[model samples]
Target: MLSYIYALAGQFQLTHERLSDMPAAPPVLLSDRQTEVLKWAAAGKSRGVTADIMNISEAAVDDHFRRIFKKLNCNDKVVAVLRAMSSGIIHL
Candidate 1:
């Protein structure tokens, strides 16, 4: 499972690198904790599991994802993870 995630991330990186000729989008800044949460999400962790691993409440985790969604202009966790990976915001 983890290897599959890594492979997907690798593909995103490769695709982005191949598009280097295009003008790059403005860098999207995320807090350290937000990045950490997205990393766990990229690892296929559930919200409760991510909260437990981070020693934060599930509500906190949800809040982080909400902010992440807004920042990434995404509405779903999977989309947010893909955007983050494509933008080199997080790695597997």
Candidate 2:
């Protein structure tokens, strides 16, 4: 019974290691402009400022955030930025 237990434990360990070795799911896809918007947002920039810096209109920035929210599956910019950072979609 002890040997059987050990064998089961060994198999479990190998399975656990194999699972860990598996690649993570691909990150959510975002457009280049969306990424830029999220990057600016991560840096604590407001949409207005990001628009000014990116030389786009505020409405354009708003549109980007709307799409970003959909892509990242988040409603708020802060959550979207956090998800993007965590998912390797964007860096700080």
Candidate 3:
């Protein structure tokens, strides 16, 4: 069971080097709201928690993540945050 779980998890893992290997695009410009959402996401907050903290709907939080992902050219939140920080787009 544990091996199966590990294999399943491995299928979804994204390494930092893999993310870095993506084309060196220009720094992505994010809206203020999207920046805030990215910060919350980096802190390991769930969509519902981020929504509450920002006083917005969960759907809005999801939308923000969608836009963030597109803007950052990353498929996952971790990669997006890493790229943002490395590109000087966000401090944290």
TM-scores for the candidates: 0.74, 0.70, 0.73
Q: Model 3 — TM-score against the truth?
A: 0.73
Model 3, position 50: C-alpha lDDT score: 96
Residue-pair clashes, model 2:
0
By TM-score, the best candidate is 1
Model 2 bad stretches (over 4 Å): 1-26
lDDT of each: 0.85, 0.78, 0.77
Tens-digit lDDT track of model 1 for 1-92: 87567657656765775678876657899999999999998888999999999999999999999999999877677767878987889887
Across 34-60, the per-residue lDDT of candidate 2 in tens digits comes to 999999987879879999999999999
Q: Judge candidate 3 against the unseen true structure and give its global Cα lDDT, from 0 to 1.
A: 0.77
The residue-level lDDT of candidate 1 at 11 comes to: 62
- For 1-92, candidate 3 gives per-residue lDDT tens digits of 86456434433443444456665577588999999998897787998999999999999988998999898766677767777776677785
Give residue 37's lDDT in candidate 3 (0 to 100).
Answer: 91
Best by lDDT: 1
Query: Compared to the true structure, candidate 1 yields what TM-score?
Result: 0.74
